[model samples]
Target chain A: MQLDWFTVAAQIGNFLLLLWLLKRFLYRPILAAMAARQQRVAAALTEAQAKAAAAEALQHDYLARQQEQTASRETWLTQAREEVVAQRQIWLAQARTEAEEARGRWRTELQREQQEYRRTLQREAGQRLLALVRRALHDLANAELEAQMASALLARLHALDGETRQTLAQAARDGCAILTAFPLPEPQRRTLTDGLQQFLSPELNLDFRSDPTASFGITLTTPSQRLAWTLDSYLDGFAAELQALIPPAGGDNASAYDQA
Target chain B: MTISPDQTILFEFGFVRINATLVFTWLTMALLVGSARWTTRKLSATGELSPWQNLLEVLVEGVQNQIRDIARQDPGPFLPFIATLFLFIAICNLLAVVPGYEPPTGSLSTTTALALCVFFAVPFYGIRRHGWRGFLHLYLEPTPLMLPLNLIGELARTVALAVRLYGNVMSGGLVAAILLLVTPLVFPALMHALELLTGLIQAYIFAVLATVFIAAAATAQEQTANLSQSRR
Candidate 1:
């Protein structure tokens, strides 16, 4: 085979030209694109990692806040419970005091009412006894009873002590009045005047009067001295004695006392 | 019948001549360049890829991997030259099965041009990587007396590279032609099929040998430098 120098030169030149064309068109652009793709993948991975870290930090912060809120809620609950218990105790104590005061007032009022009721009963009983005695003595009153009362007066005058007799005798000398429930006989009146004069003075002046209100009794009234023997006087003394015998009704012993 | 496409001169202008080999070479170059341009016109970095772009990327990445495997280094510097040599030869040989289409690799001139490129590339890469002095000193390795032998080995390997590729492609075509004259149908078709396999193998061999020569020269001093550093 004959080797051609021109052909060799031309073929080499063609090969070189083909090489430049292939490198420019095929190799460079493909390599550049591949490198760009790799860079994009790397950048995306880095950004995703950063976002994940931020999310984790936020989760931790939320957990911490939740824990703090739970602690605060627990503290508030405990304080509220304690306050409620203390308030209940205070209310219970005040209620107890009010109940005790009410009981004491009720007892005092009851005692007052009972005392008023007893007083009313005593007064009614004493008025009834006095009325009975006044009625009995009114029924029994007569001329004979008056005569006996006059005699009793004389006897009582004679039975008087020296000091009492002297007061009566001195008062009788001033002006003596003789009151009788019944009309006395002339001889009895003369007799009463002589007896009183003997006890007082021989020249004693006396006035004899008939008083219808004097029931079965005689009274000798002087300016400064009085001597009476009547059923009303005896009845007044009996009522006073009966009132002293009965005791007062109520005291503080029955006040309210609660155990619970 | 002409044995080589180079003998058929389509034009003559005084001393200069244009032959079938030259014309077919231009056609092959235009096909490769045009296809590359079309494939790379719209490339996507992250999204879906076109079937053509996938094919082109596979071809490029395959070439780079081969170079890297043989050279035991980065394939960037040697990629363009080596890829061109392999693509041109492979395309030429693969088209040989077509009726009346003569592969440019069948021409001694085209094979010589490819070998010559490898020859020049060895020294160019070596000198660039390790300086002229260090590159020249590689011939004297093991002993100074082996310099002439080393020089002859370089020339012989380059000649061998050209002759081996030319002989394989030309002989395949010659066999298919002779079988067409003799058996006329079935045997010639079989020979054409066989030629396809042989042509692909020859192209692979050419590309691999070129990569070896270049990588050996480029990394020779680097290996020596590393060895000496370790020793120190």
Candidate 2:
């Protein structure tokens, strides 16, 4: 039931002291620690947000670059395809041109070969006709044939005009000779000699000779004057007619033509 | 037989006297301060907490929440005073079971000291928040005729606060002593265990009552000011 004022005052002081001590030691540090932890958490959340934003931006950039690359690649592919088509067209045109040139060269060469063949054929035909005529004459030739040729010569000498006979007789006075493709018999030779002396001159010396290449006929020769009555003349006229009848090479068939 | 620890004077000088209440009060204070120091030396701002730190945080947060709930305001300014009041009384009463131990709350002088602290703290907080003139005007609320009655009521309540705590702790001690003389065995032990529970409850009541008084003084003028403005 009694009270102690000293103890009461002491308790009050002790309580205040305790209050100050507890505030200093306990509440302040605990609150500070909790606040620090909250600050660190907030900072970490902010940093994470920033990193996420950066990552999103990077992803956007990467997508844009990838899209651009894809577009460029498509462009390149399109350009390449166009180039390929153009090159193909160019190569096709070149190929066609080369083919046409080759065909033209081939045709030209063929035409040249055909013209050469035609010329060779014409030459062969002419030569064959000439050889056939020569062979027929050679096969038929003998003393009898020469006697007929001598008679033809005598007729030709008798049928000569006076002026031609005198000109021939004068040409014969210088040097007189007779040539035949075949050797004449003794009578045909004497006949040719007498026909020549009587028709041309009495004192005209006469000579007879044989020549195989004399065109299968007789020919008379003097230094500057000559007379002939030979089958070779007829053969020359026949060969000229045959040549006129044949078509000429190279004028019409010089080039070859074709359609596309 | 002494009903209060103040009668048990252990030391005396010519004019100053040291009693059992003072000694036990010091002991209780040491226990509280030492434990607080030990737990708060290394506070972990992050990561896992130690068991002692966890217990201390729970105790402090619980006190803060109580003050905030009852006062309907921020508990920051009131936390230290109220927490100390509960801890000191609770520990003092709880230690009564120890042999040769005296609880300081069982003394009228100690309870008066605590009640006086609350009595003064009410005005201290009121004046700190609203100024002396505004706080002094509170006793004249409703009319000046109620001034003397309100003053008497405040004094009576303070006396009641002290007497109520002293009567409970002193009577519990007295009853245990008498029961020890009568039975000396299981009944006294049971009463001591019961005293522990009542001691905790009384500490809670004391702390809550102190918070109510302080909050009432602190915010009463602001309410009056608002009412006057509304009337105007």
Best-performing candidate as measured by DockQ: 2
TM-score of chain A of 2: 0.57
Candidate 2 residues B100-129, lDDT tens each? 899999999999999999999999988888
The number of the candidate with the highest TM-score is: 2
DockQ of each: 0.52, 0.56
Return the clash pairs for model 2, or none. Answer: none
lDDT tens readout by residue for model 1, B112-221 = 99999899989999998888988888888757899999999999999999999999999999988888898997999889889889988898999999999999887777
Cα error, residue B1 of model 1, in Å, equals: 2.8
Q: In candidate 2, how many Å is residue B55 off?
A: 2.6
C-alpha root-mean-square deviation, candidate 1: 7.7
Give the DockQ-based CAPRI class for model 2.
Answer: medium
lDDT score, candidate 1, position B81: 84
For model 2, how big is the CA root-mean-square deviation? 6.8
Instruction: Output the worst ten-in-a-row residue range by lDDT, candidate 1 chain B.
Output: B219-228
Runs in model 1 lying further than 4 Å from the true structure: A52-260, B227-232
What Cα-based lDDT does every candidate model obtain?
0.85, 0.86
Each model's iRMS? 1.3, 1.3
